[model samples]
Target: MALARGFADPVHDAQAVFRTVMDALARPGLVRRLACGLAPPAPLTPELAALALTLADADTPIWLDPSLAGCAAVSAFLRFHAGAPIVANPAEAAFALIADPGACPPFAAFAQGTPAYPDTSATLILALARLSEGRGLGFAGPGIRGRAQLDAAPLPPDWPERLQANHAAFPRGVDLVLTAPGRVAGLPRSAQALVPEEA
Candidate 1:
């Protein structure tokens, strides 16, 4: 079996990916391309790989969905490159990687930090097929001036409702990183996902 490839230039590559993640989070609903070269195991894209490299570290515990968890190559790559420990329990994880957001566990299943320490909440990294092109949902909140439209298809049908409930928790909700082939988007706890009104 071949070992998965990590960043060609660790420091520089991680910094670049981190910048893109920060921009996406600061400008919720915006789609950004991650320009990195990584060949992680199956179901892991360049964007997702960059995200895992940028976010996970020695102190952070990560949980992978069944498929990814079963892949020894993926586990070894993450462990060696990011120095992140893999945990079995989702609630104990600071980060959770889900290959199929449509089949992901409910929002409440992951850690939702307490009001006093909301920063401890889990961050979910989701691998999506492709972001919706035409219609999806409207986003409103902090980063968004008025509103931003996002086409997030293949997500569970009740995602909007689930997100609404999650947002109601204020500072105590999980954050999401949605990644495609080379593109990524952030959906912070503060962002509201709403169904677009009929035209």
Candidate 2:
């Protein structure tokens, strides 16, 4: 019903959020908290809202998950604040926002940029129940020295396999930004997502 608020200081806040996102992406599987406070509609966390604000622009087409799409408040907030177009087709989107990661389509369904233009691929922003250290899946890649683990509960069962497959695509796969109440984590296409071994 009511329109949501954007950052208190647009320029500075956007820059701060953007920096946090860059840090998260640089260090895969590491969680970073956003200082900005936002109240987007249900299913969209503040972390996710901040992320969209920082990344999405008028030229970026965003694909919203069914649950998020159905919420008028969320759509209005995003449209008014981010000025990002909402696209019906996932493949055409530059950013895909998923409120329920377990209910999301397979990772392969989204756009995977061509080898010559890997930056054209879509970035997935997922809202998770919570994020913590050393519990769910393992990660190792670029910024990681050895290995890093993420506790992202309620993720899709096939996420590890999918992430590995995505990583295997090398220069042509989508990247992921996992968000919680106030924290976010990166799962770049270059990172390897490993299943925990039996204890």
Q: Best by TM-score, which number?
A: 2
Clash count for candidate 1 is: 0
Global lDDT of model 2 = 0.88
List candidate 2 segments past 4 Å from native.
196-199
lDDT by residue for model 2 over 29-90, one digit each (tens)?
Answer: 88998677777777777877888999999999999999989888888899999999999899
State the TM-score for model 2: 0.95
- My TM-score estimates for the predictions, one after another, are 0.94, 0.95
- What value does the lDDT take at residue 11 in candidate 2? 93
lDDT of each: 0.85, 0.88
In candidate 2, where is summed lDDT lowest over 10 consecutive residues?
A: 34-43
